[model samples]
Target: MHPALSIIVFTTLSGLGYGLATALGTGLLDPAATATKAAHLLALALIAAGLMSSTLHLGNPQRAWRAFSQWRSSWLSREGVMAVLTFLPLAASAFLAIFESRYEPALGLAGAALSLVTVYCTAMIYASLKSVQTWHTPLTPLCYLLFALAGGFSLSTFFAAMGGGNLLLSSGLAAFFVCLAWIAKLVWRNRMNTLRPISTPETATGLGFIGKVRLFERPHINDNYLTNEMGFRVARKHAVKLAALSFGLGGIVPVALLLGLLALGAAHPAVAVGVALLAVLSHITGMLVERWLFFAEARHAVMNYYGG
Candidate 1:
């Protein structure tokens, strides 16, 4: 499982965008406030950017539209469909906030629900893969959803601080979600560390009775698509270091910043904004490392035949 930059960007940006949309949908921010408007615009931009980046992974970007037709059977297709459908309510909510300067509770709620559903669909695209044991767990979607909320809260805190809203409440919310996100991630990593693969070379070949199966020769003299994509290997030591870094930057740092802001209480607007911005930046950077690890750490069952 090679970590593709396109998919990493898609997941990170879209998750944050949808997270912010979810907050807005739930009336976490005042619709008429300038901060709300900025948040909405940022959400839309992130979503658009993420959706577009996904096409880069396709063999034919122009034909990506065909993916929408398989929603009945494919999680990827479902994600595509939901992502598009989510835009309707999201756009309406944004329009109402910008023009009417009023929050339509119903539309906002619907948008929030749809935004979460879209992120869930995205997570399912990976979680539903039976071949990837690490991702084939309920925790996959849990981690995705929690991280999105955490990132969203962090961003909202920044917006609130800059827009002269109640920093205490927003920062508190951010801290809560950050804690949940880290907890979920820690559980996910634990599962990955201990879970046994249902597939092994011996089991895959139906020759376990013979015992101690091993690959004596390369499948080919040179690398092929399968080897290049599914046979990627990461050193255990490097993984440990990256995981620690991810936890620190993505989870610990953001939580500390939020809690610090809360403790400081009515600090200068510039100082508050700077702290919130740093939290947002650090969280995003941490998420990038985590996403890379998500792909890099996975051992596709197909690799079993290749002695992975």
Candidate 2:
């Protein structure tokens, strides 16, 4: 449950990338505009950067290619396979937008669908892990999808404010998605806080019937791989503070700014652009904290043996 910097960056950046890809597929912007070109490039850049960061978490980055071969059984494999397949259509769509200044419905839509599916696959990588009770839930994928949509919409609002499309509508949609994402996140937090341990030392050792179980001594004199990776702990107080920051910055503040942008109604393009920029920055920062807490707080079932 250690929060690896590489994985955190991978998830956040890729979510935003896929979200933007989804929006672009809807033909939301004028393909001929400079903003459209910039948006297309940015989307691909974000996705590529995220995918590359993910490789950093692997023990043998060169063997990452083998991951694609296990799509039938592994969520990670499915994610890898889908991520590669997604690029074909996304590249074609980007090429059309950048070079031809036109949107191809077939390619754009295909890329968009694949982008979402890829996100789902990424979520399933964690959601499918039964050993991590915090992550083993339907809500895991739901939260991931919603956060991606929210981030993507927020980024789209910035492009829209820059004159690539309808600023008012984009801001409104961004606000709505941010609100919805936070609501789902709030529920997730509540569940995590209230969850009873499905796995404890007694259950882990199959000794509950004998009576309460407790660790009589340390597993060893020194830490091992499992302790280093899965025995992480966070103070309840710090968690409360971080969760508040995540909600306020990632959710509340962005919504306020987005709604303000909606009210501005294209009256002041420069001000709207600045506000959108702030909203985007704040949301990204908030999401980073949330992701950090996500790993820091997770209780891996394997930790039971380590007296965690």
Candidate 3:
């Protein structure tokens, strides 16, 4: 359950990159349109960078070629397949956009749709794991997709504000997504808080004892891989604090800044870009901690042996 930075960066980066690509493919990018080309390009770059980081997390990077072999049964395989396939439409559409082809918008739409599927596949990689009861829910994938888009769109807003002094669209998008992500997060957290493990010490031991069974007559003196891996625990009060910080820094602050800039008609490049970066950084940081707590907070089936 130890949080790995490589995994964290991989997830966070891919989430942001592909998420932004999702919106861009949906006509968010128009050379002759409202948004800027620079924003679109920046998003594409980030997406590529994120995917690269994610790929680096594999144990045998060379054997990563085999990842796409079992899409029928594996979410990770599906994610790998979908993530790679997303690039075809993205490249074609981006090419048309840059070349000013009449068919660019259509291509962009196709890519956007595929990008969304890619994100869903990535989310499902975690949600489909039935062993992790805390993550075994429809909301898990839904939350992942929503947060990625929220993060992507927020990054786009910053890029757009820098290129064109328009705060209205990004602000509106940020505010709306903040509310949606918050609600989804709260729903997941509350559901997790109420759920109890289905296993017990007796079940693990097959003693069939009917009376009160405790995990320890004597305390555990040695820490092993199981305890180190699955014994991670989080304090409720600290979790609340982290959630509050995430809501404020990741959710509230960026929207407030955008709104403020809009009100004053002062969407300077620096301010807009700064806010956008801040939003991306804060949101990703919060999600990182959230993901950490997510793994740490879950009580594993093996814990029944320890009377957890």
Candidate 4:
């Protein structure tokens, strides 16, 4: 709930990487193009870098190696494993695209699938945590998937615009998908706002006498790890303002620019590349705020004891 910068970087960077891989698989990147492959590989490198940096947030870097051992029950482990495995096919495809021609498409397709799986695993890491009612929903996974797609589409628009020619088509597609994702995001936000907390103080404390329990004493004078991690609370009005800013800057502005690019028949490289850069930057930043509020706004049963 405190919103680790490492995590923010990790998610946004990984989103970009995964999105690129998806575009490659979907033929949006045109793997036959040498420039496209080069750009994609570069993006993948950025993703790997972000993920590695995120690992530092863990208490024990050495013990992080043990994470891969529990893929059976842990979404985090699955995410790590899948994240690493995805690189193999992606690198291989990039290599083949550069050196050999025959097997590139097949390898690219495999990389794309692996990338999607990695993203899904990451999504489940949050969605599966039942203690967090706001995150534990079917919509969570869908949101992650859509975000990945939207982000990927945004990247493809830039890459294509830069290397090939006009980005009008890709920008149009990005705008369309972004709008759709925004709608879904709104639905999710509304659902979360209206949803009741999964537990109450009495249930957690096992004290059956409950008409309403208000905080009678301080849990601690100073914040402990749990309080720091889970006790984050934001004003409703402030959250609404932030959400509006995120939606407008991240969603609406980019789409409007893209549509304008199309209408004006703007220069190929500038229009496409500009939109892509702005969209990814805005969206990723917005996602950071969103993820932060997501954890912060959640009402834990313990909070009721704190008179939340």
Off-target runs (Cα >4 Å) in candidate 3 are 32-36, 98-103, 164-166, 217-225, 234-237, 265-270, 306-308
Give one clash count per candidate, in the order shown: 0, 0, 1, 0
RMSD of each: 1.2, 1.0, 3.2, 2.4
Q: Worst ten-residue run, lDDT, model 3? A: 28-37
lDDT of 4 by residue, 1-308 (tens): 55677876787778778877777665565555665767667667867877897797998898888898999999999998898898888877667655663236677778888888888898898889887787888888777777777777777777776663336666677777778778878888999889977687767666658565546776778778877766777535488887887787768876776676567564555655676677767777776676666655665655665655
Q: Cα miss at 167, model 1 (Å)?
A: 2.1
The residue-level lDDT of candidate 1 at 42 comes to 93
Q: Which has the better lDDT: candidate 2, or candidate 4?
A: 2
Q: What is the lDDT of residue 75 in candidate 1?
A: 95
Candidate 1 structure quality by residue, lDDT tens digits, 1-308: 88889999999999999998887887777777898888988999999999999999898888888999999999999999999999999999989888877788999999999999999999999999999999999899999999999998899889888773767888898889989988998999999999988999998888889897887887688889998887777634499999999999998999999999998888678889999999999999999999999999998998878877
Rate residue 249 of model 1 by lDDT.
97
lDDT of each: 0.90, 0.90, 0.69, 0.73
* Cα error, candidate 3, residue 91 (Å): 2.2
* Model 3 / residue 107 / CA error / Å: 1.7
State which candidate, 1 or 4, has the greater TM-score: 1
- TM-score of every model? 0.97, 0.98, 0.85, 0.90
Deviating ranges (above 4 Å) for candidate 1:
235-237
lDDT of 1 at 176: 96
Q: Higher-lDDT candidate among 1 and 4?
A: 1
